[model samples]
Structures are given as C-alpha cells and as structure tokens.
Target: MTWSIVARDPETGHLGIAVASRFFAVGAIVPSMRGGIGAIATQAFISPLYGTDGLMLLADGQSPESIIATLTDRDDGCQQRQMHLIDGQGRNAAFTGQKCIDWAGHIIDDDVSVAGNMLVGPNVIAETLRVYKETEGTPLPERLLAAMDAGEAAGGDKRGRQSAALKICRDQDYPWLDIRADDHPDPLGELRRLYAVAQERFLHVVETMPTRANPHGLTDRRLIDEKIAALEAARIADGRPSPSFATPLKPA
Candidate 1:
C-alpha cells in the first residue's frame, strides 16, 4: 500500500521524508519529523501515533531500534504495520510485519532508510535507495524526490499511483517544505512540479519568513523583491520553464 524514505542531510542536519502510495492522502498520514530530532514513516496498518509519539521518543534520546520496539510493543496492530526511522544521531532502523503483503521490506543505508509494502517488487525500494545514494551531492529534498521517481520507474505500488508527498525540515520546528499530491494519477510528478514551482518564488519568500535565527526576518521590501527576482531569473537561465506566481499581497 505504501513505501517511503526517511533521511537526514549529512551536510545540513535537515530531515526529510518522501512517500508514494496507492492510497489516497497518504502524505497526511505517513510522514512525521522534528528539527534537531528525527523522522518517522508509519504505514501498512497506518497508526498515526508511530509518527507523533515516535518523535518524542527520539527527542528523549531513544535509539531508532528502541523507538520501533516501543511503538510496536504498545500497538496491538503491530503485526500488520510497517515503520522506519532515522534519529538525530544518524541511527536508523526499520520494520516490516510478518503479515505485510509480499514484496514488503526495508533497507538501511548510512543517513537514510527506505521501506515499503504492497509494492511491485523488492526492486522498487532497491532502486530508490540506489538513486538516493547516487545523488549524494544533491539537496535533501531533490534527492528524496529523485529516489521516489526511480522507485516509480521500477514499478511502485502494484495497484498503481494515487498520492505522494515530500517533507523537509531544517532548524525550524515547522517544515521547510511540505508538498503533496493527495489524489493524482501521477502524484510523484505533481510533487516534483510543486517543488520546482516553490523554488521560483515561494522559497524566496520563505527566506524572509520569521524564524528563530531571524526573529524579525526581512522587513525591507526591496531586498525581498530582489531576492525573488534573482531566483526567477536563475530558473529561466537554467532553461527551466518559469512559474506563474501571483503578485505578493500588499502588507496590511
């Protein structure tokens, strides 16, 4: 029914998850991460708590192996669930239930983990991990998306695509990027498009967003506008199609 990747950017400590599934709105349910903590993907039986509580456990200094065991120990449905995590220390672990559908399993690589159930075959997760490894120099978000694209090319959910998602968090408590194709014939592609569009304008605006490091953020309108324009120009110079971002709302 689902497969996912949870990873930490070695260069940035940024955490992210990318997932795709035959189920609708899988994004809203599967991925959870906290900056300076770790990430979790809970699918198969889909207990949302594995995501929420799992973060607390990780923050409490629990290892990925201990976190998984604690979560399954409390859930009666563990036999049908699949879960995986990578903690702040780079410790990673994964679980695929005995009752999971065929072709279900997970792989742990340094700084990343890949897991899935009800997929076309083991090649799906394998190729996903392979791509993530091959793209080590790419940004975490793009690397995750690339891995998912490879998984889809290798034949993703046997039943076909429905929803997909990408999430990324830096030092901020909130996500740096959270995009979803909740219900689409080609959800992964849609997520990728949304990511590209974000770079065109939204990501620049985000730079001005108030954060722990920039409590006041950027109040200079000219500076913000210049940054955004520069980003748009860079996109065009790369021979990429430009985005149709709306005019920014006038500050009230």
Candidate 2:
C-alpha cells in the first residue's frame, strides 16, 4: 500500500515526486521523471513500465490523460494498479484501478496529481492536497515534505510505514536530488533528515557540478570549497544548526 504525489512547480518548471509506502524501496519503481518532460507515480500493483514508458510518452507530446489511457489500455492488470501524472504543460491525470484495495483514489489539481491505494481513508489524499496548496510559497522539496507529513498525520497507508522517497529534477538530464529511506520505522522522518543533510553542502555541490550548458562547471576546487564554507558560515550565523550527518570536507 502506498501514497504519492507527482507535481510540476509552476514557477520553477521543476518536476518531482514524493512517496511513502508499506512496501520496500517504493521509490525505486513508483516515481519517475525527466527534466522537461513530466513526472509520474505508479503504485498498487506497481507497474514500473508505467513510469518508464510514461515518461517516454510524455516526451513524445502525449498529454497526461492520453498517456494514462494508452498505458492502462495496453495492460491487463490495470484493474489492480494506481497511477497518476502531470505533463510538461501542467496537464494532470490519474487512475485508481477498479479493483484496487479499499480507500484507493486520486485527486488532481492545477499543477499536481495525488494518488493512493490501501490508505487509511480519503483524508490521506485530501490532507495531502490541502497542505500542498496551503504551502505554495515554500520551495518545492520542502512543500512536498510538508504535504506528505500532513498525510501521515491524517493516517497514511493502512498497512503502516516501511519506506519513503523524494526525487527532484531541475533543468538537466540528471536528477537534482534523490533520497530514499528504503526500510525504516520512520521513513519520512529519515527522509527529512537526509534533506537537511543535503542542504548542508551536497546541494550547493550539485549546483557546481558539470551540466550541459556548463561542461566544465566550477572546476576550481578551492573556489567551490570557499563557496560551501561561506554558506555554512552564513547558516551558523543565522542560528540554524548544521546537519550532524555532514562530514568534514577532505582536501583534494
């Protein structure tokens, strides 16, 4: 049993997904996205092809609705699956198979699509959308965490928690961030800690990594180190504690 959200940040054009489940490593198969194509979450019976093929279809100029129809039409197991997606244009669609376990359904918004099966109740999806809409000014990743937190508070997957994941993609071929708590008593909380760990230095390091537009991106190691140090200093000065999981930077 699982619940997930696939969304496009309208202002940033970033795409991502956040998911929690009783299943192990739900993130590995349920969520998928391409920088500018779109994002998808396929769950319940977990048809991974919906994620891989869905992105391919989204890249091929198919709307989210068309993609869903095509995907479910070709699969005989559609009746047991749960899926939803948002397209490059922000067009959204979802499918909760007729035979999915109880408390299964989806809710679509202007830029988001939320879906779940075997959840505690409709409140799981409802509270997720509510919190997501109310926290619009927050960054995409934080907003996603907030929404997921609300769902958990409202009673998440009826079977209980086992894993969680967060994936974010910016304007590049590679993901900007991808973190998972594959098997944990508190997967979402673990995910939040990892998010804090990423902010400590990893995220800044990502900004300096090579990209298509900047093949030799910020290669001056000393300068990059200076930037990260400066950020850490500023964060400490503001009274925010640094993530303890962050390790000392070793010299090159």
Best by lDDT: 2
Which regions of candidate 1 are displaced past 4 Å? 233-252
What digit string (tens of lDDT, one per residue) describes model 2 on residues 1-252? 999988899998999899999999998989898888889999999899999999999999999889999999999999999999988778999999999999999999999978999999999999999999999989999999999999999999999999999999998868999999999999999999999989877898898888888999887889878987898889979999775665766888
* Angstrom error at residue 85, model 2: 0.7
Alpha carbon deviation, residue 69, candidate 1 (Å):
1.0
By TM-score, the best candidate is 2
Query: Model 1, 145-164: lDDT tens per residue?
Result: 99999999999999999999
RMSD to truth, every model: 2.4, 1.7
TM-score of each candidate?
0.92, 0.94
lDDT of 1: 0.91
Each model's C-alpha lDDT?
0.91, 0.92
Show model 2 residue runs off by greater than 4 Å: 234-241, 246-252
User: Which clashing pairs does model 2 show?
Assistant: none
